[model samples]
Target: MTTPVLYLFGSAAPPVADVAGVITDAQHRGFDVCLGLTPTAARWLAPQLTELERLTGHPVRSEYKMPGTPDVWPKADVIALAPATFNTVNSWALGLTHDFVVGVVAEGIGKRIPTVTMPCVNAAYVQHRQFERSVSELRSMGVRVLYGEDGFQPNQPGQGHPSEYPWHLVLEAAVEMHQG
Candidate 1:
């Protein structure tokens, strides 16, 4: 059986050493994923490591590709942006789709796909008035924005670790999204 296509928009561009486990976890739960990342993420993570073509049977593009060129964009059934950094989160909230990650999300919205975001910004940014408004705006647009236990987590130590895992929340949200 073919798994439904899911696209992950992530900002953990710093080659999170342990991300394979999480990707495998999502795959096992019934998804063939296509990964989109910011340039920073590319530096931190391996493009091949994300398992785009291997899993989805399509090219995973993090940048704008030539239109006439033949590349199959995985037909995303669900779109989730996890570990969403403050920069990306604010852009997404404001409907600014310049970056590839947000661009794909904007495309998802245009397609009426089930979408979710799990933000992991710094505590200060998460507490900012503008940030809160953006979250509200995203929610109003039917986008599920999962907050950390209390707010955002900037990968700080000794601050209650797993409680701030936005990726896990995205995983959970993806299950329901695919099911629905």
Candidate 2:
């Protein structure tokens, strides 16, 4: 069987800096990982973009291609959005596909792609009523949203341990969903 394609998308969060490690981990788990990032995240990782492309053997996309342009990456067998910021989560739940990452994930829902998201937000952001609502909405839509005490528990602002993000849980869920 062909290796599963994992569309691993990330937003501008502290854990995003460790995306290379995540990609490598996914590869070891038998996934052909394609990396996508939010615009701000692309800028944050600009210096490492070339290296990331080499690592994934695919272009790291951050923007939507022009109209009628063909998609570059292979069809995703599973999608995992990690370090999803407050904006990314909210935008996707509301179907605001202004950005490439959010747009693809929103469509993934309709496509019935096995998708999972792990939010990398702090306790302060969680206080916003919209965050919880968005999470609920995404879950109701069949997207496995890994948030709360079971996954990526929100830390207090300024005390976040980005290195400690539960990437394994997200990857495990992706693999499991794909197998099912």
Candidate 3:
């Protein structure tokens, strides 16, 4: 039997520092992981790209491919956008495909693929009028958004600790969604 393919998408957020850990955790849980990063995330994780690719055995993608070009990664069985930034959440909700990460996630929702998102926004960003609405919109679209106190609560602005981010929960939520 083939292992489930998990497309792990990331944005520039504090928790992104734990990305390698998340990928390792997912692999141990039976997922063949592929990583997609928003441009900002790409820049943030640039130094570790080689190591990340080696760990996942797949290329780390941060840009859209040329028209008619074949995709290098396998089609995903599930998608988890961990360390999902405030901007990414809103963009996905607004159906904005300006970047590679948002574009794929937006398409995933349209395809009705089982998806999970764990936002890593701080208290200040969470207070924005659009944040709650964006989470609601994603949930209403059948995307499992792991937010609020039970999932990811807003930390004080600029006070988030990358080590404290619930990376495992993102993987667990995706697996549960895919199974159920």
Candidate 4:
């Protein structure tokens, strides 16, 4: 059986640091992983870019391919954006496709691709009324947004436990979504 391709996207959040481990876990669960990052995340992981590519056997993509350029990564069977930041979630919900990662997930909604996202936001950010609206909008659009009690709970600013971000839950949801 062909391994399913997982497009694992990350934003510039603390939990993004654990993306390598998340990739390994996805691979163990029978996914052929392809990594995409927000521009800031790309910079954050710049030192490990080559190594991450080696780990996934595909180019790590941060920028959009130029028009007429053939896409390099395989078509994704499932897409998961973990450590999705406040800006990413809102941008995607509002159809703002400025960056590569958010652009894909935003488009994924219309493409009917099985997609999931777990936000890595602090409580302070959550207090903004727009945050709940964005989350609700994404949910209404059929994107499985793992937030609040079911996913990443917002920690107080400066008190987050990045190591405890629920990557396992995100991966589990991806597997389930792909299976269906």
For 111-176, candidate 1 gives per-residue lDDT tens digits of: 889998877665556566888888888788888888745434455433535433545667888889
List residue ranges in candidate 3 displaced over 4 A: none
Better of 3 and 4 by TM-score: 4
The C-alpha stretches of model 2 lying farther than 4 A from their native spots are none
State the lDDT at 133 in candidate 4: 97
For each candidate, the alpha-carbon lDDT, in order, equals: 0.70, 0.95, 0.92, 0.95
- What lDDT is reached at residue 13 by model 2? 97
- lDDT tens digits, residue span 1-180, model 3: 899999999999878878998899999999999999999999999999999999999999999999999999999999999889999999999999999989999999878789999999999898899999999999999988889866998889778788988887888888897787
- Candidate 4: give the clashing pairs: none
Indicate the residue-level lDDT of 95 in model 2: 96
- Model 3's alpha-carbon lDDT is 0.92
Kindly indicate the candidate among 2 and 3 with the higher TM-score. Answer: 2
lDDT of 1 at 104: 79
Q: What is the lDDT of residue 47 in candidate 3?
A: 98
TM-score of 4: 0.99
lDDT of 1 at 54: 67
